[model samples]
Every structure is written in C-alpha cells, then in structure tokens.
Target chain A: MTRLNTLLLLALAVTVPLSLLAGRVWIDPFDPALPNAAVIFAELRLPRAVLALLLGAGLGAAGATMQGYLRNPLADPGLFGIAPGAALGAVLSFWTGWAASGWALPLFALIGAAGAMALLGAIAGRGGGVLLFTLAGMMIASLAGALMSLAISLSPTPFAMSEIVTWLMGALVDRGWADVWIAAPLTLLGLAVLLRAGRSLDALTLGEVAARSLGIDPRRLQLLMIAGVGLTVGAGVAVAGIIGFVGLMVPHFVRPFTDRRPSSLIVPSALAGALLLLVADCLCRVLPLAGGELRLGIALSLLGAPFFLHLLLRLRRELA
Target chain B: MIKQSNPTPSVRVERSRETGARRVSTTLDTNGGLECAGVVLKARLADVTASLKPGEVTAICGPNGAGKSSLLAVLAGLLASDSGAVSLDGQPLNQLPAPKRAQAIGFLPQSAEVAWDISVETLAALGRLPWRTSAAEDAAAVQGALAALQLESLRDRPVSQLSGGERARALLARVLAGEPRWLLADEPLANLDLAHQLALLARLRELARRRGLGVVLVLHDLAQAMNHADRVLVLDLGAVVADGPPEMVLTADLISVVWGVPARWLGEPGARALLPG
Candidate 1:
C-alpha cells in the first residue's frame, strides 16, 4: 500500500469507534451503569456504521473508475441511471403497499437495477465507444426519473406519497442488521469488479486507438463498468435511498495525494469515502432537530452543490 | 542531387551486419517480417500489399486523404481490413493474442493525449503494460526511453507542463520503452520543430540499423523521406503508386503526377530539400 492508502486506513480506524460513540444517546464505553448500552452498541450503531462503510466504499471506488473510463473528471456512477432505477423500484413498492414486507422491497429494487443494466448494455451496443455508452446512460436516467415521478403522483394514499418522498430523500435511520446483510456482499463484489477494471482504465487515458493498441479490449471494459456501477449504486439505493455526493466528492479529495493513476486512486478513494460517510452520519445523529435528523442525501446535496461550483470556478481559472 | 561525400548506405550496411550477428545470438526472429497480402479497406485502401523487413526504415508518403494513416493502422493491428489479412511470420495477426501482438508492435497515434496530469516518467512507464515484468527491468526500460528522447531532465515534470515539442517527444518515448520488434507512427512530426524532427529521424534510423528493428513512419515531408528513409512507399488516392528506394521512387515526374505540385529535389543526397515549381 502507498502512504496515502495507509493514512486513509488509519483515519478509518479512528472514525469507526467515534461513529459508534457519538449518537443522540451517547454511550461511554467505559461506563457500566447505563441501561441497554450494549443493545444500542450491538443492535443500532454497529449495523448503521457498517452499512455506511460498505455503501460509501462502493460509491467512492465506482466514482474513480467512472472518471478514469470516461476521461472526464465530472463523471459519477449516479450518471449511469442504476441508482434512479433502484429508486423507482422502491417507490413502486411503497405505492403498491408491497414495502410492508421486508424482503419484497429490496428484491424489487435489485430487479430494477438489473433491468437498467440490461437496457444500458443493449442500447450501447457491442464494442460501442465511451461516448455512446454515456449518452445511453443519460437517457436511462431521465426515463427512470420520469417514471418515479409518475408513480409518486398516482399514489392511492397521502401517507404512501409522503413515505415515498421521504425515502427518496435518503437516510439510514432505523435501519437494522438486515440492511447490512443485503448491502455488504454486493458492495464488496462491486468493488472487486471496479478494481479489476483499473489498469485498463489507465490505458484509456491515451485515447481509444492508443488504448486498443496497448491491448485493452474496449468491449470487456464497458461490460465491467456497467456491472460494477449497477451493483454498487443499485444496492446502495435499495437500502439507503439515494446517497449521491459521496461518489463524486470523495475522489476529488483523495486525488491530489496519490500518483493520479486510476488504479492507484481507487483503494484510497474507497477508504476516504467510508471515513467521510461515518463522520457525516455521526453529525446527523448528534445535531438536535425538532423534525428528526437531517436526511443524509439532502445534507450531502447541500454540501455538494457549493463544492461543484467551486470546482467549476477553479477549472475556468486554469483554462484562462 | 546525390552527394559524393555521403557514405550513409555503406555505414548503414556495416551497422546492419553488426546487429545481424547480435540478432542471431539472441532469440530475435528476423526470418519472417510483417506483411499484408492484398489488403482492401472500403475506399480507404485498395489491394495494398507490402512486406516490411527488419533493419530498415520505411517511410509512407502521400497527400491528405491518401490512406497513409489507415495503412499504418492496419499494419499496427489496430484496424481490420474489409478483405485480406495481415500476418506476422506466417501467423495471422488477428489470431495472435492482444498482449502478444502489443509486445511485438508499438504504435503511436497522430494526436495521442494524456487524460491525467502524470509525470513524464510515469507516462513512459505505461509502455510496459503488456510486459508487467519486474520493477528493475521496467525502470531501466523507462530510463532508457527517457534518455533516447532527451527527456531525462524533464522526467519529473507533469506532461501538461511540457512544451508541445517536449510533449511529442515524451509520447514517442512511451512507444520506445516497449522495445518492440516494429515501431509504427502516424504524423509524429506534425508538432515538432526542425531540430527535433531531424533528431527523431536520426534516432529512428539508428534503431532500425543498430537494433534490427523495423520502422514504418507516416511522413508528410517529402524532403525528410528522401533524406532519411531507406525505402519509400508512395500512395496516390487509395492505391500504392510507387514502392522502392527513395531516389528511384520519389522522382520529380512522380511528384508532379501524384502530389500535383511539380516539385524537384535540391541539395545533396543526405541533406535533400524539395522546391516547388
């Protein structure tokens, strides 16, 4: 591991313990008089923190791979439409009262994600270039977003409509070990797939022709990107709603510290992403809000928009 | 325009003899070179056939839209022809595994761009992607490539910070680090200065003569081709108009008919210049 990776790993170690101890009802690990403290540690905080790490790592690694594959710094896995497709499936579950069952909701979301991946692959065609793949993803995202809106508007009950809207805002509140069980394996598998694509992504930095000459199979690369992004973003939405900015923001924070090769950036980005999410979730728990904790998705978006503007301004200055 | 003082051919023959012995001692196979048997690429190339040999520098010269770049791409195995096949040593090029083909042939595209702000040394080391050998071997190859391109001083600088000529040299150095049996480049001198162009031409000739490497360059300058190349292949429209030694193939009448410029050669053989009528 590089120095940057080692540093990020150490930071993650520190943040994990802090995340468990900093909730609304703070638990002092050294104190013995508190009631149900062990239950809170085991039942509530542990699963949430683990879920945050898994989902955040998936998104961060996916972001770095996408940027490298597209050769565009602004690329994020959310652009692939898998997240919105999963959200649409979850929204449909709520609208039909099927979400009352535990497994049906997540199962439906996974099916939705699989459908989007299939659609994207079909539309991009065999051996299609990155430009075609990107345009296809944009089309799928718009279609899924429109369908979700249609489902929300046609809800039979106002309570169902409210539930769909709040879930779309994205949070990890009241999530149990079941959510962790669903996300953990899929996220790890997705990270493995993304890592496999890293060296090929580095080859693509020299343009399509040069990459091909360097023995990179474009078709294989496209398949890996689709599979990796679909699994990570889809599973994340199935459990935690639409956590957006962790993917886009985490890579930028970790890039300057590394050698800037896509392969070298992935592991570090994943670690930094886990740390950022754990810290942010801890803050959400500790802050006093009359209407409950701030939604993780909403809070990230609030921070993300300003950071995006700052990036654009800096890029423009560099160009000038 | 031939110069009596120039002993380029004799000097090249002596170097080839020395490298020929070296090639036999090593495992280098020189019996079968890259060959395209009657390749046709849908209005871009028509029945183009050429057998390129090692220890020679061949220049492909043509006007714009004359299929120079397409031919180079086909030869580099980056493009598939509409009909016919390209073979290396009697084995079909398409049948060879991608990594194996990459190990044997290095290609530099006309407008290759770096997507990230990596250092020059890092960019050169990317050539070892197909090898993935030991750390010491990879570092030595990268160091040699940087020295060949006169980029050793700028090895630590980011590619984005280099001048246009320096960047061109850096990209070519990447192909050099691969240490392939053949090197194919398309319009590599487009952005280079005169001094850099001459230096690069000399380097290619040296690699071909001393290392027994086959070099195919797509050059726009007739003077460079006439002065530096051991053999010249001229394309008019989409067909091979002429193929032979530079002096015999690049005549004034052929230039008038093919380039429609009515140009004539001036200066000595080793330092030739073209003047338009």
Candidate 2:
C-alpha cells in the first residue's frame, strides 16, 4: 500500500509539470503577428505556473510542520493567523504606497507574519499547551482581519478598496517572475527548516514529555516552527494573496502516502500541493465561467471546504 | 522473605562533591539499582531521596498532586533538577547530555497520544532515535519489540485505528525497542482493562527478571501496587511516607494516613492482598 502511494505521488509529480507545459492555448514562438501569445506564455503563464508550484509546496510543507508542532491535524498556517497577518502587511504596504517599490509588499508581509507569530508566542507563553496557542492565534487573526476591514473602509481612493479586496481574495493572474523569485527563496528556506525538524516532530507526536525524554526541547522547536511557517505563508500571501485551503488540505491528502510520518509527509505534501494548485489553475483557464478569469482562491476553497468538513467530522468521531 | 541482595560486582562506583550534592556511589549488584540523594528536581518537583534495586518491581504511589509525576519526570530526565542530583552507575545523571541519558532510561507516560496516524512498525522505529543504529538494525529492534508485545499482527495497522489497549501495547513496544537499562513508567496501567493490566504487569516483571532492568512504575491503584510490586514507595502530600517491601509499605496505618481511605491488608505471606474496609 505504501509503495503504491509513493508511485501515485511520483506519477502526479511527473504529470503536473507536463500539464503545465502543455497548455491548450498554444503560443506561436516566432510569429510577428502573434507577439501577444509569446508574451502571455513567456511572461504570465510560465511564471504563474512556477509560482503556483512554489506556493503550493511551501504551504503544504508549512501545514505539515504546523500540525506536527502543534500536535493537531487541524493546525495550519491560516489557523494560526500567519496568512491573515501577511495579508494585513501587504495591505499596509499598498495603502502606504510602498507597492510602487520593488519587493516592498513581501518585506512588509514578512514583517507582519513575524510580528503576529511573536505575539502568539508571547500570549501562549513558555510551557503553554496547544489550546492556549490556538486561542491566541484566533485572537490575533480576528484582530488582523478587523484592522484589514478598517483599512479598506477608510481608504481615500475607490481603487484602494478594490485592490485590497482583490488581494484579500487572492489572485495569481498577473504574477510574474519577480514575485516567483521573491517567494521561491523564502519557501525553500522554510522547507529546509521543517525537514530538519522531522525527527523532533516524530518525537513530539508522543507529547512534550516524551519528546523531552527523547532529548527534544519542545519550546525551542515551537519557536522554530512558528518562524518557518511565518516565512513560507508570509511569502506566499505576498505573491498570491490569502489563498485558502491549500495549507489545510495538502498535508492531509498526502498523509496516507507518507505512512502518516511527519518526516515523509513534509516533502510529499509539498509535491501534492503543487500539483493540486497547478491543476486548479488549469481548470480556471478552461472552465466556461462568466468571469472567464476565475479567482484561484475561490476555486480552491469551493473544492476544499467539503473536504475540510469531512475531516472535521472524522476527527470528531475519533475523539468521540 | 527475599532480602536485598549485594550490589553487582561488575558495576563501577564514583562520588563527586563538586556540586555540593550528596553523592551516592554506583554499584552494579546482580540487579540494576538507582540511588538519589539531596536531589532537587524540576521547579515544581519537591526534593526527593530514594534508592531502587532490580529483581524487584517498585511502584511509586501517590495522590494526584503529590509530585509523583514530577518525580518520575525528574528520574526520566524530562525535567532537570534545580538543586540535588541523580546518579546511575555512580555517574551523575544530570551531567550527561539529553540523548545519552535517554539511551539509559526508557519512559512511558500515563497517556501518550500520538499526533500522526503512523503504522505501528514506524512508530516503534522512533524508539531508536537515541541510538546510532542502522536502518536494518532499527527495523529488527522494532520487529522484536512488536513480537514481544504480541503485536505482530497489528504492526501494519495505523495506531489511530487501534483500540485503547492496542495503542498502549504499541507504545510499550516503542519504549521496549529503546532497550534502556532503566524503565520509568508513569501510571502506565491506567485506562487498561483487567486483562491488559495483568498482561502488562506480567510483561514488565518478566523484563525485569530476564534482562535485569530496573523498573519504576507510578501507579494509583494501591491494590494493584501491593499485588504486583516487589517494593512500594508511598508518597503523601509530596513526601515519602514509606519506602520498603509491599507488605510493610501497604500497612493499614500508612494506607489510611496517606490515602485518607480505610483499607486493610488480607491474606498470608506470598499471597497477601489489599481489601477495602
């Protein structure tokens, strides 16, 4: 069963890239009459595909890391307020006119994510359990959301609110290589941190006392996990807005494949997430929707909400 | 009556006064033994002083807030002591690095809820974390532990799908895979059925006798403790009231005074029991 899951994941890895490369709308390479197609392929579609892969991988890995660290399958970057924090930061950047400057949105997003995580850590305190941390995270997320709403409400220009709303809803439409470049390095760094944390995470599955008995310092690990999640989710939101459900869904989808080990779940979830996002993007392109340009976040959430509800019901049953 | 045997001949003993804590010399008697003096445990754990010998299963018994878990935590090295010291083989336990200490000590908490839904074999493999063993060796250890626990049939099943008793056995397999010299289990028998409880106790006793492993268990059931434990360390309100053989430790006065419950010891030598008054 495990080998079959691995083979399935490998197949998905191969096919996702091929599908990304083979789009239905073919671009003519050297036709002066079709420069627009060349530009779309070179500048928009290619970068969007790459960004989708990177963002998906980052969020999935981040989700796995969060679940392991918190010792709860329900844990995700969004649940911990990292995504909303990043969105708030990006909105602040745009409202302050910093979006005119290169990389400013990402910078602000990173700062916001780090700040929210720090606040969460403070509220949770040393030796505090997951309940405390989750409560703190929920509080911070609500505070950030309220502030974001206020920012949108008080915007002087009509374009500001529309831009804020668009960003909040998340879109990968106009993302180019620059956004990809900015997110890629940070995502890779986050992945590295989480992968190195695999052994500790496994130890943690037995609870803090057991992990401590295994020579793991849970407090230090929690801090590291928070920082890693912050970096990945912050960078992702900066590039793609508040893309929901990927962080929550990807790890769970790939868990059975990894035999449910945190060590194996990290990388596979990343690959699975990248594939899911790429497929969703492709569907957005081909679907005959009225908007023609479907919001990636909306499409993902529409598919992911039921899955999330199912998981919640399963967890409830298990607990019962 | 079985008397305490002489310390093992192969073991080495040393005493150091550099930390201003009482030093207990290590001696490897036929049975693995542990000695602690002036040991100041974690911030919450009160000062504790005790000695334990192998060939005997000792149960550390106390009320909910009696620092029983904290003491176990200290002995397991999960929490570092603030003042006193613990020693194994006369070497200071606090002085060793965390992983090295873990190799010598196996700990099982009252309730261990695994976060992931991993297969039993993979979960057992985690026990070899402190060892520099190869993947094949780790696999062998996992298999051995599973077989010992009679969990071979359930090795491929996810722990989440297992029953409560099965989950406990699987975790026991994980701890056994570590092959620690000393076993410190905190309320391990809680939530288990009568059959599983008896089975677990029997397994622990077998391990202690066959491998000469020092077994320290924290139990709430005075009756079970008296029935299975060779020695009983009774704690009340964070202080040891009695530390001796089960018959002597489970006396009526101590039981009533420490537990605030009326109980009596029944039966003759070799088949003694605790009965509710």
Candidate 3:
C-alpha cells in the first residue's frame, strides 16, 4: 500500500509541473506574441502553479503532523486555528498598511500563528483534551473572522475591502515568482522539522504515558509540532489566503495508504495535498463559473466539504 | 511440563561497584535480568520502598488506592519521584535518558489507547524505539516476539480488528521486543478470560525464568498472584503490609485486611492457596 501511494505521489509530482507548463498561455495574443507568451508563462502561470503546490503541500503535511502530535484524527491547521490566526495577522498588517512591502505579511502571519499555537498549548495544558482544544481553536477562528469582518467594514476605501474579499475567497491569480520564493523556503523548513519528529509522533499514538515510557517527551514533541505547523500554515495562508479543506481532507485520504503510520504519512499527505490543490487550480482555470475566473478556494470547498462531512459521519458511525 | 526446575538459572552475574552502605547490584548473564536496591518512590499521596531481584515473578498485590501503579511508574521512569532513587545494576535510572531507560525497562500500562490504525507487526516494532537499532533488527525482534506470544498469524492484521485478548497479547509482543531487563506490568490480566489469564501468567513466569528477566506485576487477583508469583507484596491504602513468599503473604488475615473480603487460604506445601466462593 505504501509503495503504491509513493508511486502515485511521484506520478503527480511529475504531471503537475507538465500541466502547469501546458496550461499557461498569453491572454493578449496579438501584441508581440512570442515574448508575451514567454513572459506570461515565466512570470504569472508558473509562479502561481508553484505557489499552489507549495502551499498545498505545506498545509497538508502540517495538518497530518498536528493530528499525529495531538493524537487526534480530526486535527487540521485550517480547523485548528493556525490558518485563521495567520489570516488575522495578514489582514491586520494590510489594514495597518504595514505589509505594503513584499515579505511583511508572511512574517507577521507566522508570528500570529506562533502566538495562536502558544495560546493553544497553554489552554490544553489546563486539564484540557482534544475536544477542548478544538473548541478553543474554533473560538479563536471565529474571533479572527469577526475581526476581519470589522476590518473590512471600517476600511475607508472600497479598494482595500475588495482586496480583503478576494483574499478571503482565496485566489492564486496574479501571483508573482517573488511571492512563491518567499513562502516556499519557510514551508519546506517546516516540512523538514515535521519529518524529523515522525518517530516521536509514532510513540504518541500509544498515549502520553506510553510515549513517555518509550522515552519520548510528549510536551517537547507537542511544542515542536506546534511550531512546525505554525510556520508552514502561516506562510501558506499568507501566500495563498485562506485555502480550506486541503489540510483536513488530504491526510484522511492518504492515511490508509501509508498503513496509517504517522512516520510514513507525512510525505504522502504532502504529495496528495499538492495534487489536490493543483487540480483545483486547474479546474478554476477551465470552469465556466464566473467566466472562467472562479476562485480555487470555492472550487475546493465545493468538492471537499461534502467529502469531509461524509468522513465525519462515517467516523461517528464507527465510533458509535 | 518442560522440566520446571529452579526458575533462577545461575549464570555469571556482573556485580556493580558499591560505595559503603549500598550493596553491589547484579546484572543478567546472557539472559535479561534486573536488580534494584533501596528503591524509594514518592508521589503526591504517599511513599513506597522496595527492592526487586532477577529471575523471579514478583506480584505487587494491592488495593485500588495502593501505590502499586505509582511504584511501577517510578520504576519505568514514567513518573519521577521526589527523593528516593531507582537503579538498574547500580546505575542510576534517573541519570539515563528516556530512550536508554526504555532500552532497559519494558512497561505495559493497564490500558493502552491507540488512535492510529496499524498492523500488529508495525505496532510491535514501536517497542524497538528504545534500542535505536536498524529496521532489520527491529523486524527480527518483532517477529520473535510475535512467535513467542503466538501472534504470528495476526502480524499483518490491524490491531483494531483484534479481540481484547489478542490486542493485549500483541501489545505484550511490542513490549517484549525491547528485550528489556525489567518488565513492569500494571494490571496485565485485567480484562482477560480465565484461560488467557493463566496463560499470560505462565508466559510471564516462563520469561522470567528462561530469560532471567525481573518481572514486577501489579495484580488485583489474589489467586492468580498466589499461583504465579514467586514473591508477593501486599499493599493496602498506600503502604506495604506484607512482603515475602506467596505462602507467607497470601494469608487469610492479610487478604481480609487488604481486600475487605471474607476469604480463606487452602493449600499444601509448595502449592498455591485457593480462594473459594
């Protein structure tokens, strides 16, 4: 099963790049065709596709890491406050006009994610279980959502509101290579940290006491996992805005394929995530909705939400 | 019955250097074994002091509120005590890192809850975490443990699909794969049937004798404890009331005092006392 999953991931990694190359074309064909095509392919489509892949992989891998670290199957960065915290930070930066420069938004987003995770650690420390953590995450997410709404409502210009709305809806449109470069390194670094913590994650499956008996410090592992997820999800959201369901769905879809071992699940989840995002982006490009400029987030949620619900129901039945 | 001779096979025991009052600890010769002295464990509630020797199945029999599990936890280094210390072969257990401690001790908690769905072999390999050895070595150890526990056919099956007894045996395989010196089991026979209960006790005793491993089990069943344990410690509330051979510790008065149940002991010499209804 693991072998088959690895093969599928390898195939997707190759195909995604080829698809990005084939799909990129100049919108304005009549004005100096060859150079325009080259510029469009190099500048816009290539970077956007790369960003999609990176962000997708980051969120998916982070989600899997968080789930394993927490020993909770339902955990994901999007549902568990990391994405919303990052969104809040970016929006706050944008509202303050501090992130007018290139990298400020992502930097602040990472800080916000770190802050949220720290808060989660504190809350979870006080005799709280996964349900409590989930509630706390939901509360933080809702609070962030309200703050974002207030920021949009109070903005002096319609242009700022429009930008915020587009971000909230999520889009890979008009992203440059510079944005991709900014987010990619941070996300990759987070993935590396998570992979290193894989063995600790396996120990954690047997509960905190057993893990400790096996010589894993559960508290330290938890903190490291939170940091890793924080960095990746923060950078991901800052780069691509709020792309939901990829983190939540990809891990579940890829878990059985990896024999449900956290050590083997990380890379597969990342690959599946990248593929899911790339395919969603491709559909966004070709779909007739909104005159072929549909938001990738919308396309993703449309496909993912029902599947997520179905999974929840199935889990509920199994537990019952 | 495979020549049930003296369980403690005398081998070359390496003795650790002692300072003044503390005695030198003995190491297992080829076979796995453990030796502890002046082991004091303190928790929020109480303190416990005891010593465990190799090649004996010792049952820490106690009431519900007794510090049996806590003692096990301290010995396993899952919980750090306040003052008194534990040492394996005169080496301080506290000085060793978590991984090294794991290499020397195999702990089976009363209940092990796992969320991930994985095959039995994969689960058993988790025991090799402490060894930090190669995957091939881990695989071999897991296979040996599985065969020892009669779980060869269930190696590829998911742990979630196994019955409770099967799961317990699979988990036992995971712990045994570590090849630790001391086996610390908390209520290992809690949910097993009569046959499985006897089987588990027999297996533990066999391991302690054949491998020279030190076995310390926290047990609630007086009959099982009396039957299988070479030595027994009876605890009530938070203190040890009696400690010695099973015949001496499993008395009617001790059972009545510790368990608050009307019971009697009936046995001949070199036989286990039966508790009748």
Candidate 4:
C-alpha cells in the first residue's frame, strides 16, 4: 500500500509541473524575455491545477467507495444521481437567468444535490439493501435527467440556451482562485468521509449479512456514502459543470496495484485520479481543436466510453 | 425413546470455574455462552428457547422450512426476533455495542460470498475488522486462522482461484481469525463434497474442544450431525422438539415424526449411516 502511494505521489509531482507548463502559453521557467509569465502561472494555471487535483481526488475516492459498497467493479459515483442532480440545479440557474448573479449557480446546484441525497435516503428507508439503494438512485437520476431536459427546452432566450448547453458540456476554462477555495475543503471533507467508510466497505465485501455481523451499520454506511458522493460531485458540478468518468476509471487503474481491499483502494485511486484529470485537462488545452479548446467533461467521456466498452468485454470474457 | 438431560446449574458453575482458569485470555465470557428466550420471528421462527454452552459442537437439525437457520441467525444477532431476546454471556445481545458483540460471536452465512478478487490472506484478515488491532496482531490471527484451515499454502492465492472446499475453508478462516467465543454458521456444509464436509466438521470439533468455542451449526445432513455433534437440537416447524445428546435425541421415532421419512440408523455407534425408506 505504501509503495503504491509513494509511486502515485511521485507521478503526481512530475505531472503537476508538466501540466502547468504544457498549456497554451507554454511559459518556460528559464526564459528571461517572457512578459506576464508569472501572472499567467499564478492567476490562471495554478488554481486550475489545484482545482483539478481536488476534484479528481474526490471523484476517484468516491468511485472506489461506490464500487466497494455495491461489490461491483463497474460501479460509479454517478450511479447515485448526485452529479446529475447538481447539473439539473445548475441548469435551472441558467434557465431562470439567475446564474448572472454571483454564487446563485453553485448555491442552486448544491441545493439540488442535497435534494437528491435526501430523496435517496428517504427512499432507501431503514434496513434497505444495496439493491434497493441502487434502484432508488437510478430512479432519481432518471427524474433529474428528465427535468434538466425540460429546463433546457424552456430556456428564456437562445443565448441562455447556448450558455446552458456549453456549461453542461463541462470545462475548467476561466476558472479562478475562488473556485479553488470553494472545492478545496468540500472535496477534502468528502474524501475524509469516504476514507472513513473504507473499513466498513471492506467488511461489505463479504456481503451484507456478513458485513453487519462484522459490526458494519448499514444505515450509517448509507449516510456516509450519500454525504461523501454528494459533497464531491455536487461541488464539482457547482464549479466545473458536469465532469464525468474520473471517478469511474481511476479506481480501475489503481485496483491492480493494491491488495484489492476497498480501504486500500481509496488513497491510490485519489492520487491517480488527480493525475488523470490534470493530464487530461492539459491535453484538452493543447489538442489544437478548430472549435476552441475541448471541454474537459467531453474529453474524458471521449476517452472513458471506449475504456468502459473494453472493460465490459473483458468482464464478459472472464465470466465465460 | 428420547432421554432429556436435566440442567444442573451447580455442576455447570463448577465446571465453568475450572475451565475459566484454564481458558485463553481472548475468550471474553466465562459463563453463559449464548441463550435465546422465547424468540419469535413471524412465521419463520416461533417461541424458540435454548441455551448453548461453549466447548461443545451443537448441531441444529431440522428439515427444510423448519426454522433452523432462523434460530441460528437470532443467536448470531443478525436477525432480531419479533418478541424474544438473545443474550450472550448473560448480557442482552441487542443492548451491547455491535463491535463488542462482533468480537465475541463470529457468524458465517449459508452462502458467504467474496465480493472482490482479494487474496485468501486478505479475506481471512477481514475477521479483524471489529478489533482494529495492531498490524502484527492482525497478521498473527490471520496466520493462525489460515493454518487452522490448512490454507497456509494458498494464503497468497486469490479467492476466485480456490476450489469449492478451499473456498469454504477460506470463508471459515475469516470467522476463525476473530477468535470469537461463539461460532455460528448456517448450512456450512451444504455445498461441500462428503470428504470436504467430514474434514471441515473435524476441524470445527477440534476448535470447540481445544479452544472452548461455542459452535452452533444449522446442518441438513442428519447423519453428519449424529456423528460429529456432541449435542443435537432438533426443531419441528418453529419449536425445539428435542435437545440432548445426539444418540438420545436423534432416535428413529424422532426422525420419522419430524422429517416424515421412515429413516433408520445402521452401522455401529460413531460410524452410523441413515437408510431412508
């Protein structure tokens, strides 16, 4: 476990500097002729890099926890509907022209996330099993997704419609230190919560009844999962729109290196997740697309969908 | 004819005092292994009352839908009975903290599943979840458990790669790592071959005798119960029909009345087989 952590941390150290340097401006530290290089580094790249680390780490840890809870390697935090719910909240802010006011967009998204979490908890009820929880989350995701579509169709103006669409695609363009401040603590807090659930998640690997007999309180675990996924995903949607797949893919990448225990997967997954988003975001900046920079969310999905397909095929082979 | 063993509290007290002085420090309670009074779980279990003692292998035997598993679950504190109470070592089970209760009682479900591709050692180490002990302590316990199950060679192997008997042993090793005073299992031998079943039963009997563990198993094979278990508790529907030494309690008449099968025991004592007509 320590070896994996050390390796990932070393990789992160290398990638962070590269990510900051490899962007559109490409500021060389040795060059004396460059103007506003420090400004570009301080004001623009640093916060974005920090934001990537925070959100990616949060997403990765969340994915590991989710997979552990469901006992399915393919399980993703998005299965809980918190991200979609947060996106719906953000979409409403734009639809009603309230996003023009500072903080209203994030506030609305967080509210939406809270609503989804509350609904999930209520529907799951007491002594509810993982299957029941998954079904409830799927229902909430579908409901939120439909509501988001309705909001898009009823946009106040074409510009508002376009803005909402663009934001929904998810990016880190023009994100400032304010966004970093917003995500830092919430993501950290979310990671802490997910890590706290790690031992219980490991117990769950023996199935529900065995886990309970091992002192795992199902209701308490459910609460931790909801809160942790809610904070991380909701905070990401609030700042960077709807970035996806970091949570889904990072755990898979790190699983082979660890002991395959749920608790052991969390930290390494987080570090790898941070590395993945930073590298992906840097790639989006330099990819030379004709229609401006590609959205981070779209970029990940482009990479993620194929990865997902490969995973499914491999699973089929294993089962066969 | 069935012979009922009378409860002798004074004799049991004196025996407990002697055993308590000789028992390992990890054994949490010196008295009252596990007791359920008037436990009722809707239609599944009805007003079941029994007291199980440590250092004995007690087989809970009954036909399908006869509430054997339910009684075991209640004893393990996994299922709350509708109206009765399950106590461990004279303490009301539900009132105790879950971690403390877990430290004392290890339960293996009927079809325990390993959800991840974790190593056998890792899976066995999961029993230390309640203790959260030092790494050295955890490793030692896991090692002991693996050794007991004859899984030391397979410790590094993944659980998915294990054979049926090996897998069952690995799952039981997880329960053993906790060093629980009570070990309760539901149909633990159902999926194993005859040889594996006999091997596993021998290990359980040894643990009960050597470590003073209270071993309660819901068994479907009557002959196995008759041969391996020191005491047998026979259930009909949801109540205890017979509870005593297996030789006395598992009479041919009790078998016919409970199972609706005219089964007869053949072969000498300790090597008998059931022949059903």
Top lDDT model: 4
Model 3 DockQ class: medium
* Alpha-carbon TM-score of each model against the true structure: 0.94, 0.88, 0.88, 0.95
Q: Compared with the true structure, what per-residue lDDT tens digits does model 2 show for residues B97-150?
A: 888988888899877688777889888888888787888888888888999899
The 10-residue segment of model 4 chain B with minimum total lDDT is B9-18
Model 4 alpha-carbon drift over 4 Å, by segment = B1-31
Model 2 chain A weakest 10-residue run by lDDT: A23-32
What digit string (tens of lDDT, one per residue) describes model 3 on residues A1-320?
Answer: 56856686777868666655544352443455465676766787788888888988888888788788677777777666877888888887777777778787777777777778877778667333445666777787788778878988987678777777777777788889878877888889888887888988888788767778888876667666666787788788877788887888889887876778788888888888888888788777766665658887887888878987898899899989
lDDT of 2 at A113: 86
Native RMSD of candidate 3 (Å): 6.1
lDDT of 3: 0.76
Better of 2 and 3 by DockQ: 2
Candidate achieving higher TM-score, 1 or 2: 1
- Candidates arranged by lDDT, highest first: 4, 1, 2, 3
Task: Please give the distance, in angstroms, between residue A208's alpha carbon in candidate 1 and its true position after superposition.
Answer: 1.1
For all candidates in order, the CA lDDT equals 0.86, 0.78, 0.76, 0.88
For every model in order, the TM-score on chain A comes to: 0.99, 0.89, 0.87, 0.98
For candidate 4, the lDDT comes to 0.88
Inter-residue clash pairs, candidate 3 = none
Score candidate 4 by TM-score against the native: 0.95
Docking class of 4: medium
Which segments of model 2 are wrong by more than 4 Å? A1-25, A28-37, A121-129, A316-320, B1-33, B40-46
